[model samples]
Target: MSEIPSTDEALANLSMPLLDAMMTQRAIRRVKPDPVDDAIVVKCIELALRAPTGSNGQNWEFIVVKDQRVKDQLGKRYRQPWSIYGALGRRQAANDASMLKILKAVEWQVEHFSEIPVLVIPCLRGGTRVPYVPTPFVGETSYFGSIYPSVQNLLLAARAMGLGASLITMPLWNVTSARKILGLPLSVTPICVVPLGWPRGRYGPTTRKPVQEVVHLDQYGNRGLTP
Candidate 1:
């Protein structure tokens, strides 16, 4: 196991390579309304480019929206599925104690998504999907696999720079309308919308199930040591 920080100061100044970033990243749903600098956005995109892409076909684009009117319009579309998902999470929270915190956070994000400082929509050029098995699910999942590493890289970079970011894909349920708002061509697919800014609170440790539950040895039944 990785060593825990000795104090809050150590945790606050914490920065490391890839694995430590993965260990500390939390979904920062609420962000201050102050706009992020254009230079920072460019830096984040540059870091994203370093991520490995399937077949090295680096086919991606980012649309950064800071205009209030456009944000309002996109937020309107985002709220549809955000509302539905929040309702489901709320209902589940009544019976599942573990879900209560995130349910409330989702509600807050839905209410203030438009007011968040910056909105980033990541897109993929349509024809470059990595080939996968012919099954429909495989095809879709494979397409996303190619794009998400870059998304994650951007988020991790944001955290490393003390910025907050949350990857929201719920808005894509009405993909046609979203594509129209972004003026994306029919061949371009917007993979996810990311909201980013300075966070209202500090980030610290994150919780997860024991590693043994997910990791296994050479064979399927060979669960590693019970942690």
Candidate 2:
């Protein structure tokens, strides 16, 4: 009979490649001219499918967009809100150089989304009928809990394969038109659209709120163990 290894032993045997991949992942917007092959995209989709779902329902679907005409239409539709977002970001910048730099990157993304090699739409199987206000209980399982983890897994897998991707939701905000263009059924709702390609830049460390400020103890507001 096979024996199980200790937790420490398992930790010691962890794959360094995967660890590096996880540590180095970043949301890259600018990409190279080299196109991602369809076979590779399919492999990434296969990896995304392996993500666990609530009750193992696996009700996630991926729509790959490669046609330039479709991309152009999406870009045109997306620009309306993108312009508003850019204006808001500029106002928030307040002439701060660093903030302006960040906004510039965002602006570049908005302008060139259609030029990206591949656009992937992650869709949920069922629709939710809830009011604007929060509800006591919605359903057996929430769509976010089932599908978002899969999207994260997809991005991580893409990083490991030397590809880069970013999650974009501006297009999905126009849910009606977006669904019509993609031929998505009424039951299926688009969650996020990811643009994928070979990155033009290198990955960098991510900044976040300190662990001490975020983590909580037994109570909701109580600070957790000190770092």
| Most accurate candidate by lDDT | 1
Q: Each model's C-alpha lDDT?
A: 0.78, 0.76
Model 1, 61-140: lDDT tens per residue?
88988989878888888788776777777876787776888877777888898889888888888753455835567666
Off by over 4 Å in 2: 1-16, 95-98, 130-141
Model 2 misses residue 214 by how many Å? 0.6
Q: Give lDDT tens digits, candidate 2, residues 1-227.
A: 11223334423333337667677777887765456777667767887888888789888899999889888878877788988988988998877987787677767777887788898888988755665855445453475778888888778767766666887788777989988889989889888888887777766666666888888889889985787
Model 2 TM-score, 2 decimals? 0.84
Instruction: Tell me which residue pairs clash in candidate 2.
Output: none
In terms of lDDT, model 2 sits at: 0.76
